[model samples]
Target: MLYREDKKGNRISALGFGCMRLPQDDREKCGRLIDSALKSGINYFDTAFMYSGNEELVGSLLGRYDRGSYFLASKIPPALCFTKKDFERIFRIQLKRLGTDYIDYYLIHCLSDYSAWNRLCRMGIEDWIREKIESGAIRNIGFSYHGGTADFKKLIDSFDWDFAQVQYNYMDEFNQAGREGVEYAHSKGIPLIVMEPLRGGSLTGKLPQKALERLAADNQSAASLGLRWVLDKKEILCVLSGMNTEEQLSENTAIAESAAAGCLGEDEKERIEFIKSAIRESFVIGCTGCGYCQPCPNGVAIPACFEARNNFENGKNHPVFKMNPARRQYLHSTAVLGKSPMNASLCVKCGRCEKKCPQGLKIMSLLEETAEVMEPAWFMIPIKAYRMINSGKKR
Candidate 1:
């Protein structure tokens, strides 16, 4: 595997394993996958407090390995953070969950606005972070962002951050944090970790006939092509891929082993552009499922709705996503992914989600579009029956 050198001379792997979506039913299998990942030289393991059982899962799986051999990373969600005591409580909880005494990397999860940063500042978060670093509890401190470019730069200039994580992809080259943020961070010598490099798997969706043939001539899959686009950049320190299976683990590891900065040639770059045009042309509603438009005031599941619709429209041919795609994902989203089952039909046209969206999506209308496409009576019947059966069974 390839490695990047930090200022401390630590060799961080270029391909980090994202633990948010580890297989739910088979802990043994997931543990084996984690073991295999470590055996394959992927030392960076990322999880978060909000990712349900992920921290515990990562801890249990990684605890068998020697602590000094790998790196552990976790995040503190901004919504639940308020005071120094709160930060202390959460960090200690994280350490316990991960079965570790110290975190190799720590981040303030999903910083969206300056107001949240100001709140942390008022609570003396900087000094608290420094204390943790001094005590050797946190080896590095940074943040993951979901705001526009201006606020992103403001936050970059606001603190003594060690690194930054953002949603970057071939499609999102001009979106949040976009190219400007990447260049700014690179100029400052901050290691920029990339998440959603596949745009939550949208970039790997079905392609146009022409685009498919073009990529196939080079023996490429949409997923690999999408990943290589991000890996092709020099500014990206690590590309986080949430692998649920052994095959994905092997494939991404191989890619990282051979990947280098600016590896895509003129034709390959043109093919990526062609693929981008193909995706945009087929898009009915543009949403990256980034969750910035979430916590809807009326309890509507905005990103989930768009995800189902987009997947229904494009993911039917993608092998990994082709299984009862839309309804199954929608059901899963409603049941487990979020706080409530606020389907697309629940929208009140409040327009709040649109303003918050970095993509400037027509959220209310798109929710209407989502309802028209994904909430048909034929699709709703079996899902409703399944939900009822499960609810009754649990009761």
Candidate 2:
């Protein structure tokens, strides 16, 4: 498989086997996949404390092998940490879960904004991370981000990060932590790890018939085309895929070994651009986040509201949220964010935001609909319960 050298001069596989989607049902089945991946030259494995059973599955599957043979990456969930002691306790639990004494690459999970980063720092998380790195429990420190480019840059500059993972694909070049952020990280000597290369299988299986025809005309499988697109960027150190079946593992392994860097021919590039254009046309909301509609009089977090809607509609199966249960827990935990900025019911039919909107979105009507559908009683009850449970545990 192709490999890229990190800042430390260690060659990491261009394709990392993410354990969030390991084949389960039994330990033996899981081990075979892990064994096969390693035998086929996959040396990087990524899991998280929140991925249900994934840590144990990976630990059991690969623990018998020499630890030096592979690199392990996992995340520390910031939402679980209200204090420095919580960070220490969570790190210890993660190490035990992975059956490893040290993690090769450790990240602050899904950092969304500057506020979250400040919260972490206020809790002495930076000192805690430094201690872990100094103590040899963590080799490299970074964060996985799912926020705006401005916030991403703030976090990137806030700390000397070794590597950063972003949700990137052909369609999301302008979305959260897009291509600019990726390049920015690389420019700072931090390697980029790309997640959602396949857009949560939407680009592969859920493609419109016309898009499929365009790909077929080029004689490329949907998966290979999508993966090759991400690997086209020389700055991307690795692309992590949560493979679930043997066929997926085999296909991806083959692609990794043969795909050349920056090898997308003119036709391939044009086709991908066309596919991206088609995907954009399918979105109902035209929020490009120009911030024209900002300063909402009703205190509505319009951008954040749109993001949640977009995630629910377009990113339901995203690995960031789907593969890891912690994502769900974190989203639920937001209900207790010291009085949320604005709920769906707070829109109050104000037309002021509409006048400022570039896309002319009927702000009042949309908010009403969003509140009714997105904030249904069925969804809020569970989230409320989760916040209560988490709050009590902290107390």
Tens-digit per-residue lDDT, 304-379, candidate 2: 5654554455444555444333234324432323345345456777677776553456777776776665677766
TM-score of every model?
0.86, 0.74
Q: Write the per-residue lDDT of candidate 1 for residues 1-395, one digit (tens) a residue.
A: 99987546788898999888799579999988998899899999899999888899899889998999999989998779877799999999999999999999899998877778999989989999999999999998889988889888888889888898998999889988999999998888788889988887677654556667777787887777878888888988889999999988998898888888787778778889888888887777778776777789878878877777766776564477655566677767655223345788778897888867867788888888787777788766766667666664310
Candidate 2 lDDT (Cα, 0 to 1):
0.78
Off by over 4 Å in 1: 205-210, 290-299, 311-342, 350-360, 372-395
Which runs in model 2 stand beyond 4 Å of their true positions? 283-395
| Sequence-dependent TM-score of model 1 | 0.86
TM value for model 2 = 0.74
Error of 2 at 15 (Å): 0.5
lDDT of 2 at 330: 29
Clashing pairs in 1: none
